[model samples]
Target: MYALNDIVEMKKQHPCGANEWKIIRMGADIKIECQNCGHVVMLSRREFEKKMKKVLKKADSDK
Candidate 1:
């Protein structure tokens, strides 16, 4: 599972050769930004779940 601001690893490496992605937006569609190239991609929740390998860093909650 993933949440906003969480760093995650995708099952496939991005074209930029990065596997790390940061969750920037969430809803029915999830938006992720590549940590290496600043490229953003939005995928449906289902697709995101299927592509997401693991959450590397969970977002810290303020409260």
Candidate 2:
């Protein structure tokens, strides 16, 4: 499962041509920032799940 600070690959690429996003916030809505352009987007959990391809990097839990 994806968590805060995790890098995830979306099913589609952002306008900046970045396919990777960093999870910033989570709850009923999930917030993601584009790695290339620093663009932030908020999506519903359901929508996020549908659009997310996979978790590229899991967040370090040992912090």
**Largest TM-score belongs to which candidate?**
2
Model 1 residue runs over 4 Å out of place are: 61-63
Q: Write the per-residue lDDT of candidate 1 for residues 1-63, one digit (tens) a residue.
A: 678999999999999999999999999999999999999999999999999999998888534
Could you tell me which 10 consecutive residues in candidate 2 have the lowest summed lDDT? Answer: 54-63
lDDT of 1: 0.93
For each candidate in turn, the TM-score is 0.92, 0.93
Predictions in order: lDDT: 0.93, 0.94
Residue pairs whose backbone atoms clash in candidate 1 = none
Q: What shift in Å separates residue 25 of candidate 1 from its native position after superposition?
A: 0.4
Give the C-alpha miss distance for residue 7 in model 1, angstroms.
0.3
